[model samples]
Structure formats: structure tokens, C-alpha cells
Target: MKDNPLVIKLGGVLLDSRDSMKIFFDFLSTYFHNYSRNLIIVHGGGKIIDDMMKKIGMNINKINGIRVTNSSNIDIVVGALAGIANKRILSYLKRNKINFIGVSLSDGDSVLVERSKKLDFKNHTGIPKSGNPKLLFDLLSKKILPVVSSIGITKYGELMNVNADLAASALAKTLGADLILLSDVSSVLDKRGNRIDSINREKFNALINDGTIKNGMIVKVQAALDASEVLGKSVQIASWKENNEKLKLLFNGELSVGTFVYK
Candidate 1:
């Protein structure tokens, strides 16, 4: 990877919309080709997987936030993520004429994964333990953006479903890069619907306690804080829908556009 690469994670409502993906990819093309920036895109396909499972008459189960994957549904999970979702992003990148590669967490051994011990789903669910940056480095060196799916593999060659946010965190740590978690929401909003510019652990707790931050955002902010601590830098939680102007601000070393979380 470059000396200071950026890793951006995408999922939730953002991943399900073609219009949003197109706009986001356009921004990426401009950043990479026009501005000469380096970045890796990590994405999750939870909604796609859920819809596919339901169509196939499979029951969805989860322990904590990790999905349960096994012999019966690994194929569906992989197909939804590595196959459909990966291609969906790639197609947009192709339209933008950006040199990009679609890959899964297991591809090129980019991330070292094992059966998740935190959850008891046997060999199906994966927890990323470490990263091997060589493959990503080579791709980035060639100016090829890696669009990674959250699907991983175990040593035994079992396809494991990995949490996309945690996978992005592991990759950022591995490559010594900054991280940005992008979703549908623009930023962590106060009760008045204004964006909170920064959040530290104390403020995070206060926000949670005051009911300003609740539901899914609580989890997203927690993940950002964890990544910030691990990387020894701030992690950004921004939206991909704002014409990616927040990303431009972040690349310009300005934290004013998004909510920057510190450890």
C-alpha cells in the first residue's frame, strides 16, 4: 500500500442502492485518478444475503451481531457477498473507468481468519486475526483499488462469513492505514439533527446516556472508536451519499465534514 493509504468500509442502506454506488464510485475515480490518492474499499452485503436466504427458505440466525454460517448456507452467503455484491461495486467502478479489483477477504490471504471463537458457529463464521498486506500492497502499487467483500476463508478451506466492519479494521491495522466507515447516515447527529464534529470515549458514553445516540448508530460509533484506538488515530464515520464531499475533506486532512471518533 501507499505510505498513507485510506480504508473505507461500506454497508447498510448504502450498499443496497445503485444510484448511491454510482455516485460513490464516481468520487473514488476522481480521487484516485484525478487527485492521485490510494484507498481500499471494504463492503458488506447483509441485506443481499438476508434476501437471498429468505428466498431460498433458509432461516437466518445470529449470535451477538455475527451471523451464523454453516454447511447448508455457506454457498448462499458467498454467492451474495463475493459474487453478487462484489460484482455490483465492480460494475460501477468499471463504468467510472477506474482500475479496480473485486475480491473477498479470503482472496490473496489478505486477511488471516479462523473460526470465530467468540461465537459458537463452528467453522463457518470467521474472526479476522491478522492481515497479510502483500497482495493489497501489490494492487495498490499498481493503482488498482481493491474492493473487498467480507467473505473469508479458514485454513481448512471453509468459506466463513466475516463481519465487514471488523474486517475493514483488521485490514487498516495491517496496512497501517486510516479508516473511514461510510453508511447512509451523514454523521452522528445531536437531538437537534446537527452533526457532532468529534466524539471521544467520554462523550460517546454521554451521548449514549442522553439518548442522542441510540440503536444501530451506537454499534457503528463503538466500532469507529475501537478502530481509532487500534490504529492510534481518529476514525471517521461519514456518509457516502453527500457526493462524497466528506471523503474529499478527509483526504484534505480536515475532520470537519464527518464525525471523527477518538479512542
Candidate 2:
């Protein structure tokens, strides 16, 4: 259990649902109190950032479903993700009496990142180079949940915006943790609007090639694949909207509710 913690990546939309979030926290509280499992949460705030950017008349852009972040937008990204978004999650945890510490990829150099080299988008966007999970291990050993935001810092101390799914993947890989990516959708769907219960790398590639999976879901599936390959295990892509019993069963390895990405 110490070697493998449960890492859950939450989508930004979940934060907007007060009732859903309350129920989710209630489940978490009960689960933590009854079990000795170590848990880590990584969250996104894309919707919140987009709303903030709209209020400030800042244009938000994306390339291939990944946010095109520049130096001009980095501060707003941090404020939205690390500041407001992180605190909002903390507030919920506090309300639920769950012990947690809010953190970012910058904390303790947990996730060392470099400018994304694959895509020539804008500046200040990063891909995880490596991660040091000592800080996470220390926190987990003390029974503290680390709620991380997807904001990374460069070696020169420049802040960079990261895709939350990839950020979660980096942390899961570093910590040798089992990952569960919680999205608004219950599962990945086929072109005919059917849920895909499981996918392997080859099938995933076929889906992308045939245009079955596109946009942000592409990024998510890619991250899930990467984590699954690294961990030599399947990663679950489930819904944040699931009921407490379903979520509990899913986490306990008793029920399968969503698409499982395998190596």
C-alpha cells in the first residue's frame, strides 16, 4: 500500500458542482476514515481559468486540445489553478474534515518540467521531465492527502501551465501509484455513442485515426496510456458524477464502471 497510492485526477467541471462535490467529499471522508489507503488528488481548473480570462478580456487559445499558454497567461493560470482552484478544493476538504495539503508541481521540485518540445505552440507551456516523489511519500506516510494543482515551475523559476491529465500521469509514474482519471463523461464513447469499456494501445490509436476520439479526450487517453505502460497496469477513466457506492466499489477494485486503458 505504501508503494502504491491511489492518484485521482479530477476535471475542472467537478469543482462547479456544489452538490456533487459535497457527495464526493463525503465518500472520501468515509473511505479514508475506514481504510488505511494513501490518496493523492490532482485537479484541473480550465473552465475557471477560461471564465477568468473572459472577465479580463484575455483570449484563451488551444492547440490540439492543449492550452496554448504564454508568459502573458501564466500568472492568470497560476491564480486560477494554484490559487483559487487549489483553495476551493482545500475548502471542501476542510468542510468534510479531511486532512489535506494543497500543493503545486513547483512544491519541493516534485515535478521538474521543461518547455514542451513536441508542439510549437507558445512559450511557458511545459511537459514533465521528471518528478521527485519524496515529498509525496513523506506526506502520505503521515496520512496526509496532497491535493496538487497542474502548475509547474522551470529551473529558472518561471511558472508554466501543464495539462492536468499529464500532470497526474507524471505524479503517478513517479510515485508508482494507481491512477483514476475522473472526467465529466462516464467513459470514452465510440462514434456510434457507445461506451468503450476497455482499450489497448493499438485500439486507442485506431480510435484516434478514425476520428472516434478527439479534442481533450485525446489528451486524456494519451495520458492514461502513458501511465498504464509505465505502471504495467490498467488506468481507469471514470466519471466524477458516479454515485458514492459505485465510486467506492471502483476504488476498492470490486467494480468496473468506466473505460480501462491498458498497455
Enumerate residue pairs that collide in model 2. none
- Candidate 2: tens digits of C-alpha lDDT, residues 1-263: 23358889999478888887888888888988877778899998999999999999999898777788887888899999999989988998998788899999878888888878775645878887447889999999888889999999888777888888878878888888788999788999999998899999899999999999998788889888987776778989999788888987777767889999999
Clashes (candidate 2): 0
Top model number, TM-score: 2
Q: How many Å off is the CA of 49 in candidate 1?
A: 0.8
- Point to the candidate with the largest lDDT: 2
- The TM-score that candidate 2 achieves is 0.93
**TM-score between candidate 1 and the true structure:** 0.90
Q: Distance (Å) between predicted and true CA of 109, model 1?
A: 2.3
Tell me the whole-model lDDT of each prediction, alpha carbons only: 0.83, 0.86
**Alpha-carbon TM-score of each model against the true structure:** 0.90, 0.93
For each of the candidates, give the backbone clash count. 1, 0
